[model samples]
Target: MVQKPTLAAVTHQPLARWIAYLNAVITFKTPQGMRLTNQDLTHQGHTVRATICHVGPEPADGTMLYLHGGAFMIGDLRMYRHLVARLGQAARQRAYFLHYDRAPEYPFPAALDQATTAYLALCTDPAAGPISLVGDSAGGNLVFALLHRICTRDLPRPAAVAAMSPVVDLRMRAKSLTTNRRTDHLVPTSWARRGCTAYMGSADPMNPEVSPVLGQFDGAPPCLIQADETEMLADDSRAMAAALQAQGVQVDLQMSKGLIHVWHLNVGRSPEADASVAEIGRFLRGVTSRETV
Candidate 1:
C-alpha cells in the first residue's frame, strides 16, 4: 500500500519545527529540566544527565540509556523529552537521556566513548539494574556500536536493544534509501549525507563504528529495529535483521506504514508513534519480567 505523506507523517508539527529551529539557533543549551543532581553509585565520574518525568509506582527496575536523533549533527536530550518520558511510562521505570557530543566538533569515537563510559557507569548502579539501551536516528547508530563494543570486550550485554529509523548503515545503501527517497519528507538523502560527513570527518561511512548495521550483533542480547515505511532507511532494519538473524540472534523488525523517519518521536500525536513505543515497551517488559528480575 502506498502511503501519502502528511505533516504527521513527517513530524511537521509546529512544536517540532520550533524545536528544530531552536536547535539550529542555539549551539549549546543548559537543557530545561532538573539537572544532574547526583550520580555517585551508578555513574561515578561520568556525566550522566536526567530529566525526572513523573516517577512510576514500581521500583526503579532498570534504566534506558536513551540517545536522541539528529543525524548525529544536531539535537540534544530536550528534543526527545516527550518520547523518552512516554517510554519511561511504557517501561514503568525511569529513562535517562544522554547528552552526548555532537558532530562537526567531536566526531566518531568521542561520542561513542562517552556513551560507553556512561553505560559502564550506569551498570555499576544497583538502582539502575537490568539496564537496556535504545535510541533513534543517529542515536540508533550509537546503540549498534554499544552492542558491538560490549560484545567485543566480553562485558555485560543489555537485556535488549531498540532503535527507530536508525541510520545503521552510514553508507545509506539500504534498498529503502532509494525506494522511499522521494516519500520521506523530513530527512532527504542529501541532508543525511551531509550530516554523515560531519560526523565521520573523512572516516569511511561503512566503518562499523560509523555504520553498525554492518557490524556484529551475534553475542548481543535481543534486538529490535523499527522503521517507517515511507522513510528511506526502512531497509536499514531489513539489512540489520537479516544479518542478526543469520547469526541466530533474536530480532523483531517492524516496518510501520504512514509515517516518516522515527514516528515514535511524535509519541502523543502520531498513532504510529504510540504503536512503536508500545512495541518496544512490550519487548522490554517481556525481557525484564520473564527473566531473573
Candidate 2:
C-alpha cells in the first residue's frame, strides 16, 4: 500500500505551495460522480464564495453549510469538495462549501462576518430548506462562533451543528496540546498558535468570538463534536462539549482513537474517515428532520 502523506510533512513548505499541494492531492483522490456548482452569497453588500455539492437527479430538502479548516489561514473549497459532497449525499442535503476569507490578510471579523452573512442569507431563502452547519479544525471554531453570534443576534438557528477536530480554545490551555503534541501528525502547538495569532490580529485571544469555548451557547441547537482522542485538540472538543451541555444545549461528543486531526478529509480512502462522515450525516439528517417537524 502506498503510504499517505501526513499534513505536517507538507505544511512545512510555504503557504501558497502547501495549499497548492494539498489541493492537487485532494482533487486527484476525490471520488468521481458528484455535481458541483459555484454560487456567490451576498448580504449587506458583502459577497462570500460558496460551492454547492449534491448527488443524484433531484435536489435535497435541506442545506449543509460546510466551513473548511486550514487553521484559519489556509484551505479552500477545492480541497473540501469530496468531504462536502459525501456528507451531503449521506444526509440527503445539498451542501454549501463556504470559501471564507483567510486571516493575516483578512483577519478576525472578516471571516466571521462573511460566514454570518452567508448563514443569514441562507436562513432567509425559502429554497434553502432546513440548514445545518458542519466545520472542521478552524472551521469548527467558526461553527461555534457563528452559533454564538446567531444566539446573541436573535437570528434563526441551524437545526444541527458538527465540529471535527475543532480548535475551540484559543487560550491554548488544553492539556492535550502538550500531552498529544508528538502523537498528532497534523497540527503542532507552535503552528496552531501562529495560525491563531494571524487570525486574531489585534483581537484578544480569549474573546468568545475568537475562542468559542469561552462563548455562551444559550439557546444553541443540538451539536455533534468529533475529535481524535490522541490529537492535540482533543481537550478543546471535550471542554466545549461540557460547556455546551452546561448551557443546556444538547451535545454529542465522539472521540476516536488513533486518528489524525480532521481525518474525514480522507473519506474515499480511509475506512475511519468514511465512518465518521456517515455518522455526522446521520446526526444531521435526524436533527434537521426533527427541526422541520
Candidate 3:
C-alpha cells in the first residue's frame, strides 16, 4: 500500500462549535426551483428523525437513504442538509436522510435498528423504486452492516450501496490506521480507537455489526466505495471491496489522494470533493442503469 504525502487540510471544527455554526449557515434560502421536505419516521418504537430533500420535478421513484457521519456522536438530518440536497440533485430524486441515535446514550444496534426500520419503511412507501443506501464514516459502517443484517434477517436489500470513507473496521486495526495516522485531519488515531471503545460498550469490537470488517457478506448488493489516500479508513474501504468482490458482489472502488475522511463535505472549497461527488453521481447512474425520472 503506497502512502500518499499529507496535505495541510483544514481541520474540522469541534462537534458543538460546528453544529452551532451550521444552524446559522443555511438561513439563506436554497434554490427556489428545488423542493425538499424535512421530517421524522417511527422505526421500531424509535422516532428516527429524517430530512427529505427533493431535486427533480416531483414524485421521485427510487430513494437513497442517507446516514450522516459524526464518529457516532454529533451530526444529524439538519447537520447534513446541504449534502442531502446535493444527493437529491445528483440522483434527480428525493433523498431521505436518517437522523439516527448517536453513541453513549444509544449505540450499536440502536442505529442499526433505525437503519433497518428506515429501509423497511421506504420499501413500503408508494414512491419506492430501486433503492440505495449511502453513508460516510461511521454511517458507512451502518450501511455495510445494514446490508449484512438485511441478508441474515431476511430483510430487503437495497439495489446498491455507496460508502465514502467509511469506518468499517471498528477495531482500528486497518494498516492505513497506522500509516495514515499523521495525514488524516478528520480522525486522529487515538480518537478513532477511543470512539470505537465508547460505541462498543460491552460488545465485542469484532462483532460484525459493531465492526463490519468481520462480517460475512455473500450475494451482497453491488457496492461502490470512495476513500482518500490519506484517510485512516482507506484500508477499511479497500478491505471491504476485496471481500465483497471475493464474495461475487459487483464492486467499484476509487481512492482520491491527499484528502481526509468523508471529504465530500468539502464540495464547495476543494476540487477533490467535487470530483468525488461527480464520481459518486456517475456510480449511482451506472448502478441504477434506468431512465431518468
Candidate 4:
C-alpha cells in the first residue's frame, strides 16, 4: 500500500501546526450554485460560529449539522465547505457547518458545550425544521457527546445522526488500533494518542464526554456510522454500533474496504466517497422524514 504523505507529516511534529499547514496547501472547491451564509448561533450566553450551505434556495425539508474532523485540534468551516455543501445538496436540506473551538486550547467539554448549545438553539427555533447531525473523526465524538447531553437533560432530539471515521474511544483500547496498524495509512496510533491527550487535558481519558463510546445513547436518534474496515478506528465504529444497539437506538453500521479515514471528504473526486455521502444523505433524509411523520 502506498503511504499517505499527509498522515506521515504530522507523526513527528506539532500536530496542530502541521495540520494547519496541510489545510493551507490542500483545498477542495465548494460545489457550484451553492449558497453559503455565515451565522452566529447564540444560546444561554454562549455563541457558536457556523456556516449554512445550500444548493439553491434553502430547502424547507430540514437541516443537517456537519462537524468536521481534525482530531479535535484542527479543522474549520473552510476546510469542509465543499463536502458540507455536497451533503446538503444530496439531502436536499440546508446544512450548517459548525466552527466549534478546538483542543490543546479549548480542551475537554469546550467543543461539547458549544455543540450542545448549537443543538439547543436549533431545536428551539421553529424555523430550523427537523435537525440531524453528521460529524467525522473527533467531531463524531462530539456528536454522541451532544446526544448524551440531550438524553440526560431531556432536551429535544435530532432527527438522525451520522458519523464518519469517528474517534469514539478516547481511551484507545480498540484492537483494530493494533491489528489494522499496517493497513490504515491515514491515522497512526501515536498521532491519535497525542491528539487525544491534547484534547483531554487533565480530564480522564475514559470520561464518556470525551470517549463517547462509553456514553449513554438510549434516546439517540437513528444513527448511521460509516468507517473503513481496515482503518485503525474501525473498531471504534464497531463498538459504538454495538453500544447504540444495546441501548435500543436504531443503528446502521457500514464498513468499507480499503479506504482512508473520512474518505467521504473526497466527494466529487472519488466515486467511493461520493457513494458514501449519498448513502448518508439518504439515511438522513429517511430518518428525518419518519421523524416528521
Candidate 5:
C-alpha cells in the first residue's frame, strides 16, 4: 500500500491539516554550500509565494522554476529547498521554487492556474531571464500542462522542460501499474487512483488539461524525461516521450534501474541521485546553448 493519509484519519483529525506544512518546516535546513532568499509575487490576483535558491555569488546562466511534487495536494517550498539548491548548482542557474496552491481545497485547475500565473510573471521579470522548467511527479504534470498551454495559447515557452517520474496519465492505464506493483513501493496504483479522483474532481481524466500525455506537444520546447525502471509510473515518462516525439518535439528519455520514484530527491545521499542531477544539467545546457546559437 502507498504511504499517505487515510480519509478517515484526515476527516477526524484537525491536526492533519498541518502535516504538509510541518513536514516542510521540519525538513528545512540550510542545504550545505547554498543560499536561499524568500520572495513574494502577486500574479493573477493571487499571492504566489516562492524562494530563490542560489549556489554562488555570481549570476547564473539562466533562471528555472522548480516545481515540487505531492500528488498536487501536499508539499511545500521548504520540503524541496535542498533538491532545488542542488539542481541550481548542477544546471548553473538560479532555481525559483514556486509554492503554489494545492488541491481538495484548491482542486482541479487551481494548482495549474497558480503555476501558470507565477510562471508568466517569471517570464516577464527581466531578472528571471531565459527561463526553463523542471519538476517531479505531479509537478511534472504541471510542467507538461503548462507546455501545452504555451503551445495552444501562444504563451512564452520555457527554454526546456525536464520531468522526473511524471504522472502523465491520470487514468493509470499503463501495464506497469500491475507489473511493477511489488517493485515500486513508494507509489501504489491504488494511491494514484484515489489522488486522481480527488485532485481532478469533475475534470475528465483524458482531457489534456488534466492528463498532459493526451495534450498536444507540437511546437513545445525541447524536453527531457527520466523515470525509474521499477516504478509503477515508469511507463508514464515513456508514453509522454513518445507523444512529444510524435508531435515533432525533441525529447530525451532516460530510464534508471532499481531507483525509487523521484529518487533524485535523495540527492547528497544517493550516488544515483547525484548522477541524475548531473545528467539533467548537461541536457539543459545543451538545450540552452543550441537556443542561443
Candidate 6:
C-alpha cells in the first residue's frame, strides 16, 4: 500500500499573510523551462491578473482556467506557479491561473465574479478552444458555482471540469465533518465553519450558488472530482458527484485512500501527485475529444 503523507497543521485563525507564507513554503521551487507570461483583464471594473503558463510552443488541446485554494482568503499567483506549470506540462494544455481577490477584503460574489469574468475573457480568444476548468479547495467551490452560472445564464460552457478536494457544501452538513475530522489533517470543523462564514456573510449557505452541493448540474460539462478518502471534504466530492449524476450529467469521482487535501499540488515532489495530474489529462482528453467527434 502506498503510504499517504501527513499534512502540516492548519494555521490557527489563518490570515492572508500567514497563509501566503505557508503556501510559499509548500510550493517552494520555481517552475523552469516553461513560458510564463502575465495578462491583465477587467472583472466587474476591477483589475484581475492571470498567470498564463505554456509547456510547449503551441498547445495541442486547449486552455485550462485554474483557480487556487486558500480557504478563500489566501493563495496567489506566486504560490501556484509551479503547480500550474506542471499541470500545463502533464495535460499538454496552456493554463490561465487567476489571482482573484480574497475574503474580508472581497467576499462571496467577488471571487465568483472575477472567475466568471476571467473565464469570459478566455472564451473570447479564438485559439482557446474547448476550454476546461480546474481548481482546488475553495477554488473548486468557485468552479462549480461558475458552472452553475454559465448554465443558468446560457454562457459558453467548458468542455470539461476537474476539481481537487472541493468544498462543496458551505453548510458543512456532510457526515464526514464529524467522522473524519480528526484524521483529515488540513480541515477541522470549527476552522472550516469560520472560513465559510467569512466567505458567505449574510448570504444563505444553502443557496445552491453559495453551496454548489445544493445546485443543479443539468447541462453541466462532464466533471471529474478527486479527493482523499480520509479528508473532511471527501463527502463533499462524493455528494457533488452524486448530485451531478442525479441531474443526468456525466461525472467521475475518485476518492483515493492515501492522500491529503489537494495533494496533487505537490507537483514534482510526489509520485501520486504526478499520477493524479496524468489522470486529469486523461479525463480532459476523454471529454474534449468527444466534442470533436
Per-model TM values vs. the true structure: 0.84, 0.93, 0.86, 0.93, 0.90, 0.90
Worst-scoring 10-residue span by lDDT in model 1: 1-10
Error of 6 at 201 (Å): 1.3
Q: Where does model 2 exceed 4 Å of error?
A: 1-14, 17-28
Better of 1 and 5 by lDDT: 5
What does candidate 2 score on TM? 0.93
Please estimate how well model 5 matches the true structure, expressed as its whole-model Cα lDDT.
0.81
RMSD of 3: 4.9
RMSD of each: 5.7, 2.5, 4.9, 2.2, 2.7, 3.4
lDDT of 1 at 44: 49
Rank the models by lDDT, top first.
Answer: 2, 4, 6, 5, 3, 1
- The weakest ten consecutive residues by lDDT in model 2 span 1-10
Per-residue lDDT over 1-293 for candidate 6, one digit per residue giving the tens place of the 0 to 100 score: 11112122443434545656665776556665767899986645666788887664566778899998877866776678777877776666788889888875687898998999999888888887788999999999999999988988888889999999999899888898789977886665665776688788778888888998888766899999999999998899999999999999989998899587788867678889889988998998777777767
Over the stretch 128-191, how does candidate 5's per-residue lDDT look in tens digits?
6667899999999999988888888988888999999999898879999899988986775655
Give a tens-digit lDDT track for model 1, residues 203-254: 8876787887777766888888888778877778788788778878899888
Question: Considering only N, C-alpha and C atoms within 3 Å, which residue pairs clash in candidate 2?
Answer: none
Which should have the higher lDDT, number 1 or number 6?
6
Best by lDDT: 2
lDDT of 2 by residue, 37-128 (tens): 99998877878889997665454558989988888887866678888889898888888999888877889989989899999889888888
**Deviation in Å, model 5, residue 231 alpha carbon:** 0.3
Residue 110, model 1, lDDT: 75
lDDT of 4 by residue, 99-133 (tens): 88877878888889888888888877788888988
- Which pairs of residues have clashing backbones in candidate 1? none
Clashing pairs in 3: none
TM-score result, candidate 3? 0.86
